[model samples]
Target chain A: MNRFIILLLIICSVLPVFAADFWLTQILSRSIILGVMALSLTFLTAYLGVVSFAQVTLAGIAGYTIAYFSANTAGIGAELPWVFAVLLALFFSTIAGALVGLIARQSVGIYSIMITLAISMAFFYFTRQNYSVFNGWTGFSGISAPSVMGLDLGAPVVFYYVCLFTGALATLFVVKFSSSPLGLSIQGVRDAARRVRAIGIPTSPVIVSAYAFSGLIAGMAGILNVWHQERVSSFSVGLGPTIDVLIISVIGGMRHPLGAFIGAITYVMIDTFAIDLISRDRFNTVIGLVLLLIVIAAPEGILGILKSVKERIKKIVLN
Target chain B: MKFFFIVFFNGLTLAALYFIAACGFTLIFGLMRTVNMAHGALLLLGAYVGYEVVEITGLWTVGIIAGGLTSAIVGAAIQAYILGRYQGDELRQTLITIAISIIMADLMLWAWGGLTYQISLPEMLLGGVRLPILNVGYSSVRLTLMAMAAVTGILLWLLIAKTKLGIIIRAGVDDREMLQALGFETKKIFVIVFAIGGMLTGMAGVITGSALSIAPGTDMQFLLSSLVVVIVGGMGSIGGAALGALLIGMAEQYGLAYAPTYGVVFTFVIMIAVLAIRPQGLLGRSEK
Candidate 1:
């Protein structure tokens, strides 16, 4: 597993040398950013046995915070320095994630779905209706990527590398975190809250901290996303993105965190190239049908199907 | 005082719409334990179908019936064919329904275009009337909406509380295994309930078309509200749906009136409060 991830990372890092500009910007960078967003959900699902519909919302919050603090064409946010903007964005989004955890701490499974969906939708509506900070329907635009700390992110390849670096770093963090004492307890809570509580560990704080950690993961992607799109709007954080993140997580398979990138690449490929297979307008239809088939055929996602198929092949060969 | 009453009427009008839409949602969740996220799509389908029927036939009643019937058939088909395959896995079911919703929404958008359509009301249900005491003139169509909500609630109560099907449904809800062991076809009962729930939503969609306008995103708006309504009112309780709708609708309208920017926050706040104070919801039974 480690070898596979390292190999994947190597392939990603060097691909910019030969990859087309379109693929680098449209597919690679976008997937890395979206993969990180989906990573947040998958982490909770893989470890915590809960799915949050607010992963996109958390990312959006981070994106919005950066948008609010940075200089923009919309001229609504305070013109904070790039460094402050980035840090504050992550900080705010992480805190927002913890708050979501706090509010929905008790609910599990389907109940968490309801709470998270409501929270995400409520944020969507708030951004659309509130003109003061979010700038209402037409959110901030005319934002450009700022180079910082000797890195030139203005170049597509450079930005893609940054996204890759961030994504890989996050993946490493998740892998390490899952084996830590706190992470094990989180898994314990996911498996049996009653048993975990019987061991004298408070469950809510563990859950809340997990959410906060996922928030940081999502916030990193959110910051990159705003820089990639050069704008942050209500639409970015709306139900569309919210569900898209969930779909990516499911498509990648929920078992491993790295599956998010696999799912992200697949989604981005389909979304971009489906125009050739069919009309561009019917993309949603195509994607929905794909998701439905995946859910029905392999509820654990593509990774699960691969694992089972591999096991079957191994069994046949052994026999 | 006059302004308060006006806002109050507005709230009631919105509440009626919400209750009507949420009825089917609560019903499906109650019997099948499936969230049926595609409910809003079903409602939108009914609304569009109703509009087309009314446009061709020039009869509002026919449009309403046709809309309801179409949604009923579709809803039953979905449950019986797709959702029934995975009976007890709520998460998988929810994901499937969500996929269905996305497909339906996209397909509907393809067929209907992005234009908004409002179902024209019958002459009798048109126009407005001045309230006797408050002197606030409200749309007659809105009044009819409230009336239809009441009718839906009462008739649903009768079906659940009085009828044999209702008894079986309640039994199924209480213990699906026991109900199945008792030789009852719980699957068939689930399809029936889905159909009934779909019918309620379809009619509500038609009524909503007359009361307001619907476009591409209307499905999502109703879906989110239904989620909140059922969550607040209790998962599968008709009375809870009504109460939840009323509170949400009232709070929403009042917030919009008093603080346009923070209107949505009020509903969020209320939901959080309910979850904090009563995780099972206001009238919801505590989970075992």
Candidate 2:
């Protein structure tokens, strides 16, 4: 599986050169960024049994921080070095994630969703209304990708490579973390919190750490998101994006890290191509229907279905 | 003092609307433990339906009833077809409702064309009433909304506190298994509760449509506010909903009056504070 993934990443990195399709590269990069965001959500949902609607919000925070620190049209944050700006954005997002984790510690299930939803909504409104800081609804622009080490990172190929590298690192981290002691304990808590607690595992910190780690991943995605778009707007971080990421996470399968990328690819494909078949106004209708069908038919997502098919094929071969 | 009174009255009216919308949410939560994310979409549907009714009949009251009934039917369908199968799985229920809301929102956008629509008030409630104490004019429609909220509140209170159905609902909330063991058709009760909840949300939607305006994305705004109210007042408690509404409404009014840009932030700040201090909410009983 690891070799297959590495081969796929290599193909993805070079495909842009052979095809030279700017739009395809853009979509692929977007899918990678969204996949990273969904990976964070999958990390929390798969391990902690917590479905947070705030991953986008955390990403938005990082995006805003990037917009602030870089020389942007909005001129909010000081013009800092790109590395410092990215690091600070990640720091803020991690802190925000930890705060949310602490706030939602006592609640489980729907209560946690509601709390995170409220926070996201609050951030959305705040950014929309506060003209001085968020530049109102228009948001900040003129945020080009930073050049580093004598390489023009703003070039599409380089940026795509950046996204691919970051996505790969995040997926690897999640895969390794899932097998770690803390990750196992968190999963144990998801299955039986009381039993885990009785067995001498301190569950709350584990949960909060999970949130922070997810935040870090989401923060990296956020920085990449802003660099990709060359702007940060309130719309990107609003309820729409929040739900979009949730749908992506669920559509890919919450059980495994690869599901996030699969789901992101599906979502980006639909988003990119749906306009060809239908009116722009009814685009969401198609997406909604697809999501509903997936929820109803394959609750475990596309990966789960593929896994089952693989299992059945193996049984047939044995027979 | 006059400014304060005006703010207070405006806050009270807003609180009344919040209470009406959130009570149903809390009730549904208390009984079914299902977080119907589609509640907002249902409210928006009610507003749109009510707008059409008023456009046709030119009677606000008729529109309100039609809207409520339409939303009730939709809500019942959702509860039966989608939520009913999920039972106690809150996560699946939440996702299902989110999907339903998305579909409903797209349908609404297609029908309404994303324009903000409002239902006209009746002739009697068209203008403001002179308040001698405050020496100012207050919108009669707002006063009527307060009266409607009071009536709904009283009726809901009676239904829950003074009826056998209420006892069953309370019993279900306290212990679903025990209620099931007692041979109560709890499924039927869930349907009834969902219908009533939908009706209340629809009615609130129409009222809100008349007073404010309803657009494609209004459902999310209303949903967020109702969630805040429920969180502050304590989920599944009528009195808690009322208190939460009052606090949120007053805070919003004052924020709008004093700091218009940050008006929405006040409710969330209150919510976060409540969550930090008492996760159970102001009037909610802590559960194990």
Candidate 3:
């Protein structure tokens, strides 16, 4: 299975070169960024059993950080080096994630959802209302990716490769971290926090660390997102995008990191194609129906359904 | 002092609307443990329906009733078909309701157009009433809303405190299993509660539509405000909902009046502070 996945990744990496469709490449890169964001959410939902509506807020935080530090079309540009900007973005997101984690630590289930929703809404309004920093609703634009190793990072193919590399790295990091002792303990806490506590593990720190790690992943996605779009807006971090990430995570199957990518791909494809078939106003209706059907019919998501199908086939063949 | 009174009156009026909208939400949450994210959409649908009814009949009261009934029916259908399947899975229910809300919102936009709609008021409630004490006039519509909310609060209290179905609902909230064990058809009781909750939300929607304006995105704003109210007041408690609404409404009015820039920020600050100090809420009991 691992070898097959690696082979598939290699094929996907090079296929963009042969296809060379600008729109397709853009969609793929956007999906990958969204996938990275969804993966961050999957980490919390899968291991911690806590579904947050604030991952996009974290992503927005990083995006705004990059916007603030980078040379941009906006007059108020910091013009810092790309590396420092990214590092600063990651740092701020991590702190924000930790703070959110601490704030949400005590709440469980529905309360957690409400708290995160409240916080995200607050952030959205703050950014939208405060014109001085966020530049109001229009937000900052003209952000371009910096060049590295004599290659123009803003070029389509190069940017695609950058997104692919970053997405893969983030996924691998999640996979590796989930297997680590801390990750296992976090899962243990998810399953039985009291038992884990009795066994001498501090559950709160573990959960906070998970949130921070997820923040780092989301922060990377956020910076990449700004580079891809060449702008950052308050709308990107609003309730809509936050809900989009949740849908993507759930559609892909929150049980695994790969599910995030799969869900993002599906969502992007539907979003891209559905507009062609239906009126613009009715497009969300289609997406909503699809989401409803998926949640009701296949709660485990596309991957879960596929896995179950494979297992059934194996059982039937053996029998 | 007059400025303060004006702010206070505006706050109270807004609080009344919040209380009405949030009561059903809190009741549903208390009884079902499901956060109907579609509650906002339902309210929006009600407002749209009320707008249409008022447009046709030329009577705001008739429009309000029609809107409430329409939403009640839709709410019950959603509960029966979609939400009922996921009994205790709060997350799945939330997602499903979100999907429903999205669908409803889009449909509403497509049907009603994206323009904001305000329900036309009757002639009696059109003008402002002169308040001698504050030496200023207040909108009669807002005062009517406060009266309606108070009446709703009293009626709901009576229903819960005095009626047999209310006892069953209270028992169900306290312990679902025990209520089920008592041989009452708990499912039927839930349906009734959900329907009533939906009716209340719809009624509030029409009132809000008349007082303010109902647009495509207004549902989300209402949802957020009600969620804040519920969280601040303590989920599932009517009195708590009232208290939460008052605090939020006053804070919002005062903030808008004083700070102007950070008006909405004050409500969130209060929420965070309350959550940090008392995670259960101002009136909510700690969940076992």
Candidate 4:
């Protein structure tokens, strides 16, 4: 199963080079960028047992920041470096994320969920109404994509490779972080908060820091998302977007970071094709039903089932 | 002064409805330790049933009763078959309930076509009288809701505080294994508790629908409000849920009347303040 996934990944990574329209390539690129955002969620939820509903809002904050800076009117000057704008936006999002995390850090269990949900809702409404800067519900348009090192990165295929490379780098970072002592401690905190606290691990700071880190990644993805679509709106930070991320993480099983990408691909596939097959209004119904079946039949997700099958085959051979 | 009084009265009315809905959610969470995300969906299910009943039979009381009964039956069956199977594992139970919620919500959307449906209340109950403080048109049905919910709250308090069944439930919440060892059927207790919780939610639904009408996103809105109530009330405390609902209701009402645009912000501010002061909730049991 691992080999098969890897092979598929390789094929997908290399396919655009052979043949593809810019539009189709853009879709794939957007999915990867979304995958990055989902990957950030994977870190907090899968690794840390904190099912934060605020990551998308963090992304929204960052995306709007980027758009505000890059907007032709009353935004950052065209002469001002785009890199500076992206960094500033990311910093803003990280701070916003930290503030939200601080507010939410005190509560555990369902309270945490409510706190995050409230914050997300507030951000969504604030953005939807704040027309002076955010351009209100209509959102900002015509923000030019960044041009780094004289490369026209706006090209779909070029952007796809960029997303692919960045995704690989982020995945590596996540894997390393997961294997580190800090990551193990996060997991420890999740499993037994009292035990971890009793041992003097100072779990709260660790979790809060993870939230910051996760926010940074999500913010970066948000910047990329704005670049990909050249648009940012209130809907990007709403409940639907949050649920989409959750579906990706949960469907892929929150156990591993790779699950994010796997889940993202499956989600994009389902979302892109499933609606066409059925009444468009029933899309949520289909997705919801799929999620129900997954929860019922494969609580550990696809990875767990494959692992079990692999174990069974090995046991049989050994016997 | 009159305007303030009107806002206060409106807030109280909203709070009464919120308390009715949150009562069941808090009870189930308190007993089962399960975060039934589907509770809001179940409420919607009840509203839809009531909508159908009122549309067909044109009897408002019958509709409300039928709605509550339907929710109770469905809640019992799900608890027995799905939630009961995963006793003690809160996370798995939550996931199962969330799945159920998702399916139920989708099915509701499919059935109801995202249209707002109003219950056919009797004219006497639908109209209102002007109070001296304000010329308010309050629904007589909402009055019934307020009265019914208050009575239900008292009955529940008596059940849990003054009866053997309540004793067993309280004891079981503290130590399920001990309750089991004491020859009590904890599973049966869970089913009964879950069904009652569902019935309460159903009652809240029909009442709210009768007051405000039923719509597609109504479940989500009510769920958000119930969550706020549960948080402020602290998990598993019936009185706490009521207090939270009252506070939120009043806060939301004042917010809508005064700020208008910042109603969501008002609820959130209270939530943040509560979370900062008491993370365990105003009424939640101590967590070490």
Candidate 5:
């Protein structure tokens, strides 16, 4: 797994040298950002045994924070330093996620789905309805990427590398944290909450911490996403994007964090190239069918399918 | 004082609509354990079909029947064919239904376009009526809707309490394996529950189409409302659904009227508060 990530990083690092500007900005950067967001859902689902529809809501909270604090086309912008804006965004989003976790701490499976779904939709409606802070439905525009240190993130290649590095760091954090004592406890909670409680370790804090960590990851992606679009709106956190994250996580294989990137790249590929096979208007139909097929045929997603194929090939060769 | 009466009546109308849409959702969840995430799409499909039928036949009653039947068949087919394949795995079933909803929403948008459709009201249902005591004018359709919701609640109650299907459902809710051991066709029972739920959703769709308007995004709106209602009350309990609907519907209308901007927040607060206080909901039975 380590070797595979190293190889993947090597390829990604060199992509800007060979790939077109369009590919760097639109395809790769976008995929990395979406992958990071889906990683949040993947982490919770895999570790906490909780499926959160509010992951994007957490992301949007950060995105909106950046929009409100940073310079904006809308007059409502506070025009804070980009660094401050990003920090505050992360802080607010993490809190929002923790709050969601607290409310839904006792729930799991279908019940968890309901609560998170409602919370996500409520945020969407709130953003659309509350004009003073969110600028109503128009949201904020003309928000450009900021220079970090000496690097101009406005450059296409720079932004691509930025997203790639963010994704890599996020992946490493998950990999490292899962082995930590707290992470093991979170996993234990997933396996059997009643047993964990029987051991006298309070389960709610672990669950809330997991959500907060994912919130931080999602918030990072959300900021990158806002930079990617150069705008944030109600559409960002709406049901469309909420479902998009779920589709990515499920498509990538819900259990693995790295699968999120694979899912995102595949999803973004379909999003961009499906127009070649069908009308642009029917894209949802195509994607929907893809998701439906994945759930029914390969619940384990692309990674699972690859594993099975490898096993079958090995069996045939041995025979 | 007069304005208060209008909002109160408005709240009733909204409650009635929510109750009609949610009872079916709770019914399916109560029996199948599947959340039917595509339920909103089903409701939207019913509204579109009803709109088309009313336009073609020029009969409101036919439109209602046609819409309800279409949703019933489709809902039943979804359960009997697709969802039934993943019995006991609630997560997979929910995921599959979400996919279905996405496909259904896109296809409906293609077929119905993005236009806001309002099923025209019949001649007798038109105009306003004076309410007693308050003597304030209110829409007759809303009154009819309230009456219809009450009737629906009673009919559903009877269906659950009186019919053989009800007995199977009650039995299934308490113990599915036992029901199967008793020689019941569990899959058939599931299909029946989905059909009834779909019918309620369809008829509610038509009613909502006439009362307000139906558009592409209405599905998500109603779906979220149903989720909140079912959560706020109790899952799988009819009385809970009604109570939840009343609370959420009244909260929604009152919020919109009193606090123009933070109305969503008000409804959101109620859900959070209820979840915090009673995770099982107001009338929901706590699970072991």
Candidate 6:
């Protein structure tokens, strides 16, 4: 297993360089960003039983903030340095995350899902119409990427590494959180809110914190997402992206943290290749059908299927 | 006063339209405790049927009936065959239904491209009638639609409150175990309820399609509306759905009327406010 882990890491590191000739770099980076978003969702859903439908919206808010801040204030020649702009974007995104958490954490079950969807839709439409700030539908272009101590930050390969590093950090944080006492408390709250309350556990704080954490992760993904697109539009964070995140989380197996990474890869690959194979018009049909099949077969997602199969094989071998 | 009347009447009309769409959604939700994400997809299906009818016969009434009936049949079949088997599993049911919705939406996209198609009402039903204070005029078709909705509501109310079948349904919602103890096939009841809900959503689609315009993303938009209605109305309450629909309808029209720019924001604000204030809904009965 240790060797396999090293081999897997080696493969991931070298594969991007090999596929750099094609659009695989973009694909991998997207998968990573999407993976980060999916990881946040999986953490919230699995531990808290909160299937927030606003992960993409949070991402969009982060992206739009970055774009807006990075907009050339000084007549295209100078601006409030890339670092400040990025910080401003991150701060705004955190606030957006907190706001979403506060509002969405009020209700439970499907009602909460609807509330998140509504809020996200409102944000999407608001940004789409408010041209003065978000530049309306045309969106803000020429938003430069972040550089570390004056390194050329505009390269796709550099951006990919940035995504990789953040994605890895996000994944590690989620795993650490999941095994902690806090994670257990969250699962406890989800499993039996009444019982937990009876035992003097404050349920609301856990849920709110989960939402905030999820938002922070989503915001980070959003920053990376804007950097990837280099042009943020309302279309970037609408129902389409929202649904894609849901599909990735569910398909990857919401049971485990690693499932997000797996689901992100499959969803991005399938969505991208499906679009490449056919036109954009028929993409949803194919994606939807795939979603249906995956749900029917593996309700726990791809990870669930893999685990179940592995267990079955072990049982057979022992017999 | 006349302008007020116009907004009020328009709001009611919109509410009536919303109620027609939400009835099926709330009914199924009542029994299943599952939000059928595909209800919107089903609405799109009915709209397509309407479109096909208009293309085939060029008669508005026939198209409406054909579209509604097709939606009902499809709804019934899917519920009876697929959802019926997944009784008592809310989470799995949600997953499956979402999948079904996606598949249906895709199928609709394949069958009818992304272009928007409008079905014209008959010449007789095209214009509005005048009243004293306000021109209270609208497509006669909408009037017919209101009448049909009223009839459906009355019948559904009777079925839920008056008939033996309705008693079984109520019992099923209150306690499936006791109902099953009495040897009633709750699964069959669920299937019937789901079918009826589908039929209602289909009818709504046909009416809405005729009233406005049916397009590819119509289902998603309707689904969002239905979710708002159900959440605002109370998940399992029929009356709640009607009241919720009316509120949303009024809010939407008035919001759009008052500030055309913030029209979309209005419904969302209401949803957030309602959920925050009364998580259950105005008329919703609390479940233990």
- Please, what are the lDDT tens digits per residue for candidate 3 over residues A216-278? 999999999999889998898987898899889888898888899999999998888877888
Considering DockQ, where higher is better, how would the candidates rank from best to worst?
A: 3, 5, 1, 2, 6, 4
Flag regions of model 6 displaced more than 4 Å: A1-7, A21-24, A72-79, A275-281, A313-319, B135-145
> Per-residue lDDT for B105-195 in model 6, tens only?
8778788888988877777777766665555665566676667667777888898999998898898888889999999988777777777
Off by over 4 Å in 3: none
Top-lDDT structure, candidate number: 5
Query: Comparing 1 and 5 by DockQ, which wins?
Result: 5
Model 6 chain A lDDT-worst window of ten:
A71-80
| TM-score for each of the candidates | 0.98, 0.97, 0.98, 0.92, 0.99, 0.93
DockQ of 5: 0.89
Per-residue accuracy of model 1 over B53-110 as CA lDDT, tens digit each? 9999999999999999999999999999999989999999999999999999999999
| Residue-by-residue lDDT tens digits, candidate 2, B8-32 | 9999999999998887788899899
Q: Write one digit per residue (lDDT tens) for candidate 4, span A63-165.
A: 8888887855434324347888889878988787778778887666655666787788778877776667766677876766777888877777777877877
Error of 6 at B220 (Å): 1.0
Error of 2 at A218 (Å): 0.5
Instruction: Give the range where candidate 5 chain B is weakest over 10 consecutive residues by summed lDDT.
Output: B1-10
- Candidate 3 chain A has its poorest 10 consecutive residues by lDDT at A17-26
Summarize candidate 4's per-residue lDDT along B35-122 as a digit string, tens digits.
8788889899999998899889989888888899888999998899888887866666766777677778878988888788888777
TM for candidate 4 is: 0.92
Give the top-scoring candidate (DockQ). Answer: 3
lDDT of each: 0.92, 0.90, 0.89, 0.80, 0.93, 0.78
- Chain A only: TM-score per candidate: 0.97, 0.95, 0.96, 0.89, 0.98, 0.90
RMSD of each: 1.1, 1.6, 1.3, 2.8, 1.0, 2.6
- Write out the backbone clash pairs for model 3: none
